[model samples]
Target: MTDTDVLVVGGGPVGLGAAVEARRAGLEVVVVEPRAGTIDKACGEGLMPGALRLLQGWDVDPPGRPIAGIRYCSGETAVSHRFVGPAGRGVRRTALHEALRRRAAELGVVTVTGRVDDVEVLTSRGTVRAAGVEARWLLACDGLHSTVRRRLGLDVDPDRPAAADARRGTDDRRRYGLRHHVGVAPWTDLVEVHWTPTAEVYVTPVADDVVGIAVLGPRGTDLDAAVAASPALARRVADAPVVSTTRGAGPLRQRSHRRAAGPVRLVGDASGYVDALTGEGLRVGWAQARAAVATLDDPEAYERAWRAATRDYRVLTAGLVRWATSPARPLVVPVARRAPRVFAGVVERLAR
Candidate 1:
């Protein structure tokens, strides 16, 4: 018999989500990861209402502050939108991971605490000898720069001529994200996104007494400098004490020519990423995880499902990122404030 029906690589939210969902689908699942306890990553920490609903369906509720809406601020201009339905939550990454880990254990998903390297794909199975685990199928949620994608020859070939934009210097620019937690009471249930000339600072309350600040900007952008650029956010956290060391996620972009190759499948950031401007990473990723396992019987179905699941995010995020980086970047907040109805509609649509 195969060691497991589905072996999930990476134990972050996406990996864990896949493992749990696979087990729920009545498959024997095993997760291979190097980390043991709750895993944390640099993230905005805001779960959109739709994301919360998705997690709830899996019965994986983690403690956190309730988020009612979203707010955009730049200089003296500001725009806000409140969800028409249930509010979202802002759970810490560690908390979210631990909750899912516990649920996975309860559901009998085994965990092998070891890293997977040099994956070998056999005719009917995928094997990671370093971890000595083999499964009929593999779901690589290994993250932004997936090792599996590279080992499988799915990554963009560096030797290949760069894309047109890269040749034109546009692709040379890359964005990264940094996050830290501070001890303080949140001022609003709405997630406040402070847009600056060079960065976007996201203020998300993860607990009754703590808030997380995530900054996204060009490479080498300083977190402190970014925070200081946002007046409203600076004032709010001026007196708050830092509670967590800073963490980061890079390039904010990844690529995968295809979703599946042989027995290995890429999910979450491993599959590909656009940008986090809309704060819908978790929602899109969770959807992909579910779709990944649900379509195991027909791997090609995953490509269609993945595209459908990420359609909104890909379109909206790409459009917004382009606008944010263009010469009209300075007009973002002002235009949002000028067109309240339109801005609210976009925010609500993305929040879903």
Candidate 2:
């Protein structure tokens, strides 16, 4: 009588992740996405060590891409650290979408390539009905602007949605996402963070002979502007050649706040969001998927797990964003550069 046991709305990283885990847990999952091509959401694509291990729980091994550790450079100091077990993996957004979509197929999650016109939460036992498809369970996994979050009134407000919950600041200081691929090799074994007066650029060695840069800057500044401002990164890529296009995720007032309402649940950027500063967005999504599947037996329990896995990261990420954006380069640069042990310690704790 229904299309599937669980209807996952959206085909982004989180949605695919939810679908994958749901099917693996024996739930008949259906993913509804409106887009025609690969759903490449705006992101700085890097899976953290915690996320990579979580993938193994779902029988997903990260594609064989090498990620050394972390290299951080701010105003006065620069530090690089070698990675521990399964440091992490970096894949482009488009490539990750495609690979996950393919994996979803292997997992037997039904893919519906269309948008939902409407949804009705049937009152009987508090079931979720979307576009006449009755799902024993429902997942928002849609994204920050999740329609499910809105429909269920689980978001902060009727008109505001998730706009009022996250930390905000003066518009004069803005943050934008910028990504560019370079045609160079082995910039080093560590992921690099180059900080200028106005912005911070993260360098990821994702592919065989290429490195990806995701820089966050002010509203008027972009990837091109970041490149111009940072002679260090520019010279490193001078011979490497620029490959990926510049991209940005417009700063929004709120992130998703609803993890579940009745049988409905949210994941990744859908339930809430992570600032690009953490480079842990994908891991957050994957971790939520694991939690969601475990909680599927009872959506309420799932929400608990989701919140537990994310609460610290969300708070930690908020503080990190402030630090990354702060003008205290002298104090920040030295810590980020010379003493990666502190950062590594923080990361190890987060992974656990």
- TM-score of every candidate relative to the true structure: 0.96, 0.88
Cα lDDT tens digits, model 2, 292-349, are: 8787767678767988887877888777766655566446667654566787776565
lDDT of candidate 1 over 138-254, digit per residue (tens):
999899888888888888643343475566556522778999999999889999999999889999999989999999888898888999998778988998999999999888777
| Residue 328 displacement in candidate 1 (angstroms) | 1.3
Q: Predicted candidate 1: what Cα RMSD to the true structure?
A: 1.9
TM-score of 2: 0.88
Q: How close is candidate 1 to the true structure, as a TM-score?
A: 0.96
Candidate 1 local Cα displacement, residue 296, angstroms: 0.5
User: Which 10 consecutive positions of candidate 1 have the poorest summed lDDT?
Assistant: 122-131
